[model samples]
Target: MERSFTVDVFKVVAAQLIVWHHFSAYGPMSEAMTLQWPQLIEWLYRYARLAVQVFLVVGGFLAAQSVMNKPMTHPVIHIFNRYLRLVPIYIFALSLISLVVAILRTDIHADWLPSAPTFSHFLAHALLVHDLFDIEALSSGAWYVAIDFQLFVVLVVLCNRLQPYGVRVLSLGVALLCVASMWWFNRIDELDIWAIYFFAAYGLGVLAAWAKRSAFDAAVFWITVLLAVGALWIEYRTRLSLALITAVWLTIKPKSRVHWTPMKRVVHRLANSAYVLFLTHFGVIVVFSALWNIGHFHDPVTAFALTGFAWGCAVGLGLFLHEKAEIPVHHWLSHQSKLMFLRLTN
Candidate 1:
C-alpha cells in the first residue's frame, strides 16, 4: 500500500486545527487570549471544528481502499478488527482523562471540564455507544471516536451485504445512502451523533476511492458534486462544504510519488499520531486550564505562553502514546485477530 502524501498532509493539518480549536474553545487560557485576541480565538472556536469533516472524508477514503484492495474477511471479524484497532489506545486515553477530570474536579470548577464519570458512562464509552445513549462524554471530541466506529461498521456491512449483487449494485446502494444523508439526514441537527448524518461525507470518500480506481465513471464524481451542491443550495453548511471540497480534491488529486524527505517524515509521524492526539489533547488542555485557575494566570501573555506549552506537551504525549502504546497494542491485537480468523477457517 503506497502512502499518500496529500492525505498525510490533510491529516496533520486537520488534527492540528482541531487541537487549536479545542485550545480556543476550552478553559481560562482561551478566556484570557480572547481578551487580547478576540478575533483570532473567535475564528478558531467557530471554524476550526469543521476540520472534522476533512477527517470523515479521509476515513471514508481509507475504508473504501481497505474494502477494495484487501481480501475480504468475515464481516464480524472485520468489524471486530476495527474495534481492536481503535479501543486499546482509546481505553488508555479514557482512563487518563477520567483520572485528570477527577483530580481537577476537586479543586477547579469550570463548565468546560467534563463531569465526573459514572460506571454507565465508562461502559458506554468503552462500547463506543456513549453518544447514542446520550451519555455525557468524558473528554472533548470523544463523540468522534464513537461516530468513527459506527461509520466504519456501517460501511463494512453495507459493502458485505451488497457483495453478491455486483459492483454496480454495491455502488448504487452506497450512492443512494449518500444522497439520503446529504439531502435529508444531514439537515437534521439532532441526528449528528449517528453515522447517517455523516455518511454523505464518508460516502463521498468512498466514491473518490472508487473513482480513482476507475470502478465507476468519472461522471459519477461529477454527479456527487452536483448532489452536494444541491444539498448546500437547499441549506448552507460550512462543514458540508468542507467535506465536498475534500472529496473533490481526493478524487482528482495527482498521484505523484512523495519523496521521503525530512519534512515528509515529520508529516507522516504527525499523521500517524493524529488519532492519539485527538484522544489525548483534551486532557492536556484540562490540566493547563486547571493550572491557570489555581495560579491566577489571567494575563494574556502568560496565558498564551502556557497555551502554547500545552499544545507542545499534547503533541509530545500523542507521539509517545502512539509509539509506546498504540502501535504495540495494535500489532498484538492484529496477531490475535489473524489467529482467530485462521481458527474460524479451519
Candidate 2:
C-alpha cells in the first residue's frame, strides 16, 4: 500500500506534539518555561500525552492494511517482524538514556531523572515488558512501543485464525473485539498496561481500513461510524474522540499530491522521521536536563533560549538517526528476517 500523505501529516504532527509534551512536562527547562509561559506549559503538560492516541489509531490502520484482507500465512513471522521493527530503535534509545542517566545521576537531584538501571531493569525494557514487570520506565512513551507490538500480535493472530473464513467473518470478528475493548476493557484504568485497554482506538483504525477497501458500498464505513458513536455515547473520552477524528479523516481525505517538489521531499522526510524522533527525543531531554542543572539558569529569557535549543537538538538528532541509523538498520533487519523465514519454511 502506498503511504497516505494525510496520515503522514498526522504522524508528524503527533510526534512533534509528543516531543513538546515531554519538553514541557519534565526537567529544569520545563520548570523555567513554566515561569515564563505558565499557561502554555500547563496546557502542554496536562494534555500533550493524548497525542499517543493518534499513533494507536494510525498503527491499527497500517497493520490492517498489511493483513486484514489476506491470509496471514506466517503469523509468527509477522509478529517477529514487528518486534524487530520496534526493538532495535528502542534498545538504541534505551542505551542513550542509560548513558545520560549514568553521567548525570550523581550531579542531578531532579525527581524526573531515573536512577541508575540494574541489569534486570535494562533487560525488562529491551524485552518491552517493563511496565508488565512493574519496573520503572526509563523514558516517556516507552509503553507505547510495547503496546503497539502487543496490539499487532493480537491482530495478526486473530486474522490468521478467521481469515480463511472470508472477509465478512474476519471483519465481524475484529469488530466484535473492538466492541469488547471499547465497551468493557477501555474504561478500566488498571488495564492500561495491556493492549486491550487501547484496542478500541486501534480497532477503529482497522475498521476504517476495512471500510476503505469496500468503498463501493458504504455499509462498512457506516458500521465504523456507528461503532465510534456508540463508544463515545457510553462515555466521552477525549482520546477516543481524537482517534475517531483521525480515522474518519484519513478514510475520507482525498489522495492528493504535493506538486511542489521541495515541500514534498520535506514532508516525506519528516513523516519517516516520526518514529525515530519519538525514540530519540527523550535522550536529548535527559542530556538537556543535566546541562540545565549544571548551568542553573533562572532567568526566563535564558531558560526560553535553552529550551528552544534543546528542542532543536532533539529534532536534529531525530532526523540524523532516521537517515543514518533507522533506515539502514531496518533494511539489514528486513534481509535477516527474510532469511530466517525462508529457513523456517524450508
Candidate 3:
C-alpha cells in the first residue's frame, strides 16, 4: 500500500495540538489564562493527550512497513540501530531540559513538568527507563518516545520469529496482543509504564497495514476490530476511540502524492521532523516562560498574547535543533553503532 497523505497532515496538526496543550497547561500564565478561557483550557487538558494515539497508529503502520519487506534476521542489531537513532537526539534534549529545569527551579513551579534533577533521575532518562522507575519525566511527553522504541522492538521481534510461519500468524498474534491490552492491561494505568497499555492503538496500525494486503484474510481484520471495540464498549475510553478512529482511517488507504510544491514540501518536512519537535519543545517553553516572568503586564490578555508568541518560538527552536543538531548527531551515532554491531557479531 502506498503511504497516505493523512500521515503528514496529522503529524503537523498533532504536534501543534500537543504543544498548545502543554502551553495552556503548565505555567503560571496558564493559570491566569484559565480565568478568561476556562472551557478552552479544560477541553485541551482533557483531549490533547489523545493526539498521541494518532501518532501511535501511524507509527505502527510505518513499523509494519519496515519489517514486512524483509525478515528481521538481526532483530538485535535492528534494536540497537533503533536505540542509536533515538538516543543521540534524546540525550541532547534531556541535557537541555536538565539545564532549563536547574535554572528555572526557583522561578517556576508547575505540577506536571520536571523539577530539580538528580544523577539517578538523569540516568533513568538516558536509559529511557524513567517511566519504569516512576521518576518525574524531565520533559513533557518524553515517556512516549521510550514506549515508542519498546513497541517497535516488540514488533520487530514478533515479525522476525513469525516470518517463517507467515504474515497471517504474525497479524493474529499482534491482534490478540491488542485485545489483551484494551481489555486487561490498559485498565491498569500502572501497567502503562510498560508498552502493553498502548499496544491496542499501536497494534491497530499493524492490523491496518495487513488489512491492506492482497493476501490478508478478511477474518483477521474484522476480528481484530471486533474484539478491540467490544473491549472499549465494556469500558468506554475516549482516548481509545480516537486511536480506533485513526486506525480505521488508515485502513482506507487514502491517496498520497509528492508534488514537492513549496507547501507540500513544508508539510513533508514537518511530518519527518515531528519527533525532533516533540523532544525539544518543552525546553523552549520553559526558557520562554522564564523570560515571560521578567515582565508584569497589567492586562492578562497581553500575557496570553505573549504566550502565543512563545509557542511560535518553541516550534522554531524545535525545527532548528532538528536540522542542525539531531540530524548530524544521529548520522554519526547510527553509523558507528552499525559498524560496532558488525564487528561484535562477526
Per-residue CA lDDT of model 3 for 1-346, tens digit only, reads 4545678888888888898888777876777778888888888877886798888888888888777768778788778778888887888888888888788766666566677788998788878899887888888878988999989988988888887798778888888888889899888988887888899889988888778675464467668788878988899988788888888887775545646678877887788778988888788778767766655543568658878888777777777888898888888887788788779889
- CA RMSD per model (angstroms): 1.3, 1.6, 1.9
Candidate 2 similarity to native, TM-score: 0.95
What would the per-residue lDDT of candidate 2 be over residues 1-346, giving only the tens digit for each residue?
8777777778888988899999898888888788889999988988888899899989999898888556688788888888989899888987888898888776667777876788998899888899998999888868888999999988998888988887777777778888888788998999999999998889888887778566532366567668778988989889888988888887777766555568767777888888988988988888877787787767877878887898889888889998898889999999988998789889
Report backbone clashes per prediction.
0, 0, 0
For 1-346, candidate 1 gives per-residue lDDT tens digits of: 5789999999999999999999998888898999999999999999998999999999998888888744344688888989998888998899999899888875568876788788988899999999887888988878999899999999888878887777666777778898899999999999999999999899998888788666463567678789889999999989999999999999789888888999999999999999999999999998888888888777999999999999999999999999999999999989988998899899
Would you list the C-alpha lDDT of every candidate in the order shown?
A: 0.89, 0.84, 0.81
Q: Per-prediction TM-score, please?
A: 0.97, 0.95, 0.94
Candidate 1, position 207, lDDT: 83
Ranking by lDDT: 1, 2, 3
lDDT for model 3: 0.81
